[model samples]
Target: MDKPTGSTVSPQEALIYAMVTLSAVDRQMTDRELRKIGDVVNTLPIFGGFDTDRLVAVAEACATITREEDGLHAVLATIATSLPKKLHETAYALAVEVAAADLHVEQEELRFLELLRDVLDVDSLTAAAIERGARARYRTL
Candidate 1:
């Protein structure tokens, strides 16, 4: 986290960073989580104009920040600043999706999601809906 060198990032990149941070919060980023991030970038209309080539760099940046003291806060602040109000819930949704990617939500991931909800200013009701939607999407028979 060494105070991210840059203060701003595009909304799409901000979303990717959020997902990357959530995936690594448990100190391990699984292939499932990484795949989920790639799926998101490829399918989400929000990312229609985003350059997929930057995914690796964005994830690396997130990983670097997560190692610094209060890096989580720094990363969340960057996410909040980079995304427009309309995409706040989208960001939270993306985090929740990544958290559930492995089908087992770790305590750290849950805490990160809570922090993300608060940082993104997503109301409890909206947060609940987003969380539920992600759960339904990732559900298996």
Candidate 2:
């Protein structure tokens, strides 16, 4: 679905693609993960001016791409190209948050994070810090 991540893909759509890709990587979109996606859209400053009504449609578009051949790569490419350099870290953070939401980060999720880090050119230190923050935020009592 490279076409889905085409030139017209907005930054918001790119971000959603990142989160959806991670949440679907394990082939199980847990309630916590799904809720995290919704929360991120509703609360984050980055998502300011975004249309809540389009949330489901954007998410479905991304989810569809993830099931296609090299869909993950397609999504990542769209994200890297569409988002400004300032948002690379933000995109990674969003993905990490969703991965941690279920409090059981699967191996597939970890691999996707690693790949995303590289694709986004996120420094290892920054990536580790964001990941740690997500773990703290989602940790069980």
Top candidate when judged by lDDT against the true structure: 1
Give model 2's TM-score versus the native structure: 0.92
Task: Write one digit per residue (lDDT tens) for candidate 1, span 22-119.
Answer: 99889889999999999999998999988889889888988888788989888888898888889999999899999988999999999998888887
lDDT of 2 at 38: 96
Taking all chains together, the TM-score of candidate 1 against the true structure is: 0.92
Sum up the clashes in candidate 2.
0
- lDDT (CA) per prediction: 0.87, 0.86
lDDT of 2 by residue, 74-118 (tens): 777777888888989999999999998888989999999988888
Clashing residue pairs, backbone N/CA/C < 3 A, model 1 = 1-65, 1-68
Show model 1 residue runs off by greater than 4 Å. Answer: 1-6
lDDT of 2: 0.86
Candidate 2 local Cα displacement, residue 125, angstroms: 0.5
- Model 1 per-residue lDDT at 38: 97
